[model samples]
Target chain A: MTGTITEAAGAADASAPRVREMSMQQAVNAALRTVLREDPRTLVFGEDVGALGGVFRVTDGLQEEFGAERVFDTPLAESAIIGMAVGLAMNGWRPIPELQFDGFAYPAVDQIVNQLARMNYRSRGAVPMPVTLRLPSFGGIQAPEHHGESLEALFAHVPGLKVCAPCDPQDAYRLLLQSVRCDDPVVYMEPKARYWDRRPVELAHDPGDMPVGRSRVLRRGRHATLVAWGAMVHRCLQAAEYAAEDGVELEVVDLRWLKPIDAEGLAASAARTRRAVVVHEAPLTAGLGAEVSALVTERAFGALAAPVERVAGFDVPYPAGPLEPQYLPTIDRILSAVQRTLEYKRP
Target chain B: MTDTTERTFALPDLGEGLVEATVLEWLAAPGDRIGRNAPLVELETTKSAVEIPSPYAGTVVRLHAEEGEVVQVGSALVTFAVEGPAGEADDGAAGQAGIVGRVPQDGEAPRRRVRLRPPEE
Candidate 1:
């Protein structure tokens, strides 16, 4: 299948590609398997990725065919894995290391920000970290502490990292391949909870069609513009579905890449809807949502329907217990923000 | 010992398309009893730490690749000795050469395995 949304919809070629219903994790596995088979240089590494096939079985059976050299296990150390990846990138290899869970990525923040991210800039573009760091992030899985934290904001704050989250299986497959092929380092956030949720995806499109830092308008609306990424993209869609019953039309933009933001798309969306609401898994303060909101307000001040509202995680460390529901963004929360934004009158 | 029990395991492309990877450490050795999906070795690729699972349920008879040596894709990494069903012997080399010939070309753009391409690009 081409995975090209445009081609899939219009092509009169009745011969459709084979389709299978797999979970998000499975889709990711398929993507990895395909890439690894296609590119002999693409390697997968993470804790328990071999015999255990990763704690989530995202890498099951890889070792058998790929052998110990290509598909093996790493020590239970996050920092070491990332640091090693940096070294590998320096030596002309593409590394895709899994952070395991969202919370575990913190241990490697130093290598990520100070070393991997800055290597290219400090070297005056002589060297670049083409490594792709995959993080299974966000809550609702009911996992323990540090497992479902949304830390894209932290990486987004850095200058070098290209942060993105794929909402579905097709995006999971395509975005991952794209990230691996990209020249700059990319932080690919996988929403653990929505691994199995199914939606139709395009088969093929021109490579490099979806550029980094471009926000995709997932759905069109006239009342408000909802800017979101990763898991929240799904939530925003759900919120749009529900709001439709109440005659509320919303424009939803999936901010696929974070660092080099799609300011133009966002500003244009805000111009059409005249209302903006930023949503994310991170807290409002110092979050990417805040940055996006500020950017829209500063750029689209003349076409404002109301102040840009943000729906995001609370300002606290992600809780271990049931508080996870409250820690991350929700559909209701997004809807409420949309309603609030729509209600705000122009001064 | 029957020759039918021996199986040749080809190196799989770990999630990354690394040309060659170093065996950072070996978890299993020759003559070790191994099961399908068992942890055979810990490999350090250019990306991260990873473990290689046993592709065959058998004993490790021959170690083809050494630690710290860069091994290429489709290369033979290990030979497994298996117990055939009901006193029967198996050929380890049979049905494997075809696999080597079918290795997908690297760096092809993403093509959907199922379904047509979407309408709006």
Candidate 2:
């Protein structure tokens, strides 16, 4: 069932009423539709977004209402799409482009780096690329090649672009709008496979309300901290739930923003738990999880109860449909990592 | 030597090397003139809806299949008739362009930038 749309329109506004449960993809679609209605500057585009409503039906019914000119589809050009977004943002239009799948985003690397990432810095703050690239990311969907990738590090490494991932439907609804309204370009990574993951959600239409570059501590536990974002957050939570039966408590943090990370929140959390575990779907070699774990080790070295741990996808190409399960970090892997960290004796 | 050409249209890898695509609709019929890489057919894959470009700068001599049909890798989708020569148009391996890299590989450690820590209690 549909929930009451948010009455408020920006970050300065207060929370409105609550609503019923909705799928994450639907929540995101609602947010996009609401934003387009409220703001004339908002534009949504990507391949198949106009007619096919996207591969996952995320953009369903948008073109019919907004018209193809507003919510339109583009030629099969990822780099051109992103580059065009930079131009549109420069012209004061808010563009939310869909990358279709996380794995398929590689072709736009040049545009993302050369234009999208450094738009502000390149323009010396004279121009702000208010573009939101929604990338439906991660594996476990049993998809074919270029369908199940998690390339957060590729965006996070760039200085100008802000990287964010939402853990649940609620976050997906809110942060998506926030990403669109932000002054800087944001790569909003959604868990592609979890599009149908349902949860109780309250909707809002506001922008400029949610703070960028912040992480939310989902559960409070003293044993250790389990940090994850996007789809991995659910996995981490599941691992914690199963671990709790075995007498282990874990503090879970959903890092909504990957870039300009909430170092303060993380440092404080590490001080309490005195241990850390970072999880992501990207490969471990030079991945975002490593960057986070390194940050914890560097800043909160004295607050350590155990070595910083990371649970991530293996360092090989995300396998085909059948082998994808082995590629992603599972509950067993996370729990074992936590156990290993707990059993560590400081030497 | 006659003034005819055989341009073989190899299905382009729609960015992620999507091995197969479903023929959603055929925009051009047989014997239709298609520019080089002009969209001859529309394809719906698991990734996105894509327009299959005409690999040859010639007339559409034949269409390999019908609408709503599933096409496999290395299967010929269309053939074009060129004007000048009697040689094969060397359309290289179907390549994907302007794509976003989405997945991490196997056998490698997955890297994460955010470490979870306990909140202040």
Per-prediction DockQ, in order?
Answer: 0.02, 0.03
Q: State the iRMSD of every prediction, in order shown.
A: 15.8, 9.7
Point out the worst 10-residue segment of candidate 1 chain A by lDDT.
A3-12
lDDT of 1 at B13: 51
Every candidate's chain B TM-score? 0.66, 0.67
Cα lDDT tens digits, model 2, A197-257, are: 7787766534344588888899998888999998888777777776666667789999899
Q: Identify the runs in model 1 with alpha carbons over 4 angstroms from their true place.
A: A1-19, A201-207, B1-121
Which segments of candidate 2 are over 4 A away from where they belong?
A1-18, A205-209, B1-121
List the lowest-lDDT window of 10 residues for candidate 2 chain A: A1-10
TM-score of structure candidate 1: 0.69
- For every model in order, what is the number of clashing pairs? 49, 42
